[model samples]
Target chain A: MNPFSYARASDVADAIRQIAADPAARFVAGGTNLIDLMKYDVEHPARLIDISQLPLKSIEETPEGGLLIGAMVPNSDLAYHPLIEQRYPLLASAILAGASQQLRNMASTGGNLLQRTRCFYFYDVVTPCNKRKPGSGCSAISGVNRINAILGTSDACIATHPSDMCVALAALDARVHVAGPGGARTVAFPDFHRLPGATPERDTNLESDEIITGIEIPAKGFNANYSYLKIRDRLSYAFALVSVAAALELEGDTIKEARLALGGVAHKPWRDPAAEAAMRGQHAGESAFTKAADLLLQGAQGYGHNNFKIGLARRAIVRTLSQAARGMPQSQSVKKIR
Target chain B: MAQPGTAEPLRQTDVLPEKIQITLTVNGTRTGLAVAPWTTLLDALRDRLDLTGTKKGCDHGQCGACTVLVDGRRINSCLTLAVMKDGAEVTTVEGLASNGTLHPLQQAFIDHDAFQCGYCTSGQICSAAGLIAEGKARTADEIRELMSGNICRCGAYPNIVAAIQQAMERS
Candidate 1:
């Protein structure tokens, strides 16, 4: 890891000021991802501003009957929080489905959103990766792309975002609170992460000077009917190959509203409001679920190694929607298909 | 690729930033150490404080061999910088036992033969200690799921879960 100076921020303002002052400075909270990147020589921060001590670790109920989760809250704490588990169980299930207990304990809510892709070539540094070094060429495009993105992928990059929590957040329409040089602003979950248009280096819309303060989930949490299904090589401690976050608000056996998001399939948590709308007012059954799945997988392009992901993602969507419709959210502790 | 712990141009800085002074209450011993900002807590424990009980299996967060309690919460010490934990209380495997009496989890691991090679035992015990404190994992499946972070390449998972269950009962 490259040597860097350490500065502990006294407050959020101090953190914003420090990061805004230095373009290369990074805010280190829950040093799970950034430290790993630094160790891999992927990131080189001139200074590490310790923002873990900042006053942002609370999970409070919003006036709008939603939950406002501080960025500093550990992934474990957030997943186990009473309000989160009761109201936003989709988010809870998604969080629990990711990484492991130890990693979730160290990973923060804010840092999880900004985590880099787990692309092999990107981390190898020796290999040619457009995300790692733009214009060097994307090795995953022709190389081993078993885990590359299928939707919204540019020719320059095909890396998928590896966050399960963000997938749920995208489905739930969570708003991200950020403090930057431009002052404080809220970014909607879909707008937070960016597609690898031509610049694969930039993963998020969040500027280098900005510090994410908290994430706010609205009142409609889809708590009654939600399921997070992550299919991976291993049952646990593995990244998802095709993960779906399905949530529905049903009127009897009819779907009143629906939200669907996919992880490990695109640069960001893949969501289609149109596909979700396709399920609205439809009976909560295979027919409606298949319609949504077909619409969601529309125009999904897959590389050689990951060609099966398109079909796999389609099946996963239907299965996840079925699970959500029955209020039988997939258990994170249990690996049972039901 | 540069593996962990092979000192290759690990200077303080390109501009030579000074070492950061931090205080850590490790297993009740309050110690002061001036370390580089990039020095991981695992390295600080083994190389500086000589707390070799906490093993460094992957040096990355992939493996939980460097698991330790930072302010009573279990985390990957390898991924955590010592400087980031400025005034924190860290408990390693060496700290788990007191008055020469092994912790319940430590004792249970031995009784259940939870380990073949003992490389990952310390981390498993420390992680189990944290798991018990959390009071979440009740069933064997829950223990297996929660303890998935600590990988035992020796295939001692059945016994490891059993040992954790025993320790949870004692706690």
Candidate 2:
């Protein structure tokens, strides 16, 4: 890794001021992803503002009966938090289904949201990647792209967002609280991450001077019946090929409401209102689930090697919804990989 | 591609930054050290502090050979910067045995022959030690799933699982 000046921020204001001073400066909370990218020469920040010491490691209950997760809270702690496990079990399961025990211990909730895609070409400095180098072109477009995106992909890039927690957050209608040079603001979960449009270099809509403070999960009725299913090449320690986060509110036999999001299939968590709308007032069964899945994958187009992801994602959506509808425990059904 | 640990050409600058001082309790010893901003915790332990029990396999955090406990939680030391962990407690494999007496997990690994080449033994033992402390894994499947970060190419997983189970039962 290249040498850089490191400074520990005293608070959020100090962090924002420090980062705003240098364009090449970045905030390092967990260093799980940033340090790895530095080793691979994918990132070379001139200055690192260490925000790990800041007091953002709380898991508090909002007055509206929702959970407010601090950005610096470790993934392991957040996953096993009594409030999260009891109320937002989908988020807990999604967190557990992403990384191994060791990585989860080191990863922070905010850092997990900012994790880059595991696209092989993106990591290999020799290859051409639009995300890595603005106009270099995407090698994955014509190379091995079994893990690339199948939805919300652009001609410039085909990378998928490699986050299970973000998928669950999108399903639960979570909002992101950000502190920046301007001031503090909240961004909807779906809008926080950006699609790979012409500017594939920008992974998120967050400004360069902004730092994520916390993630606010609104009290949802789907916590009782939600499932996070991740399918991967291995049973553990690998990235997801296709993962589904499904939550349903059932009124007896008919679906009163539905919340759905997909990971490893799009630049961001793929959530379509039409697909979620198809689940409302529909009977909970294989037919209705399949119909919703088809609606979810309607406009999904895939690259050469990753074309199979569309089918895999459709099946995953159906299976995840079925599990959620039955309130079946999401244990060992999906694998955790980081 | 330059693999990690290779010395890279330093960029020419007018002024060089000063090393950052950090205090850490290794095993049971509280030590203070100054490290460069680029130095990883794994490098500080192995090169600076002369603790080589922690192997550096895949320094990019892909392999768990560099696993260690920071504040009693298992993490990839290779992925953590030394300067970031200013006043934390770190436990390496060398810290497992105290007063010439091996930890129960270490003894269990030896008794069950949980290692062949032994390249990944230290990491496996440390990770299992953390797992036991967490008190989450109850069954063999849970053990295997939780220990997936530490990869043993020699295929010593069954014996490792058995050893961990024995240690769990004893504890």
What is each predicted model's overall lDDT from 0 to 1?
A: 0.91, 0.89
Which residue segments of model 1 deviate by more than 4 Å? B1-14
Model 1 residue A220 distance off true place after TM-score fit, in angstroms: 0.8
Q: Compared with the true structure, what per-residue lDDT tens digits does model 2 show for residues A120-193?
A: 98898877788888777888988999899988888999998999999999999999999997899999998999
Q: What is the TM-score of each candidate against the true structure?
A: 0.97, 0.96
DockQ of each: 0.51, 0.47
Candidate 1: TM-score of chain A is 0.99
lDDT of 1 at A88: 91
| Model 1 lDDT per residue over A1-338, tens place | 88788899999889888987887788899888899989988787888999988899999999999888999999999999998988899999999999988899999999999999999888877778778776778889998999989999999999999999999999999999998877899999989999999999899999888889999999998989999999999989999999999999999999999999999999999999899999989999999999999999899998899999999999999999999999999998889998
Model 1, docking class = medium
Superposed Cα RMSD, model 1: 2.7
Runs in model 2 deviating more than 4 A are: A333-338, B1-12
| lDDT (Cα, tens digit) per residue for candidate 2, span B36-91 | 99899999999999999999999988779999999999999999999999899999
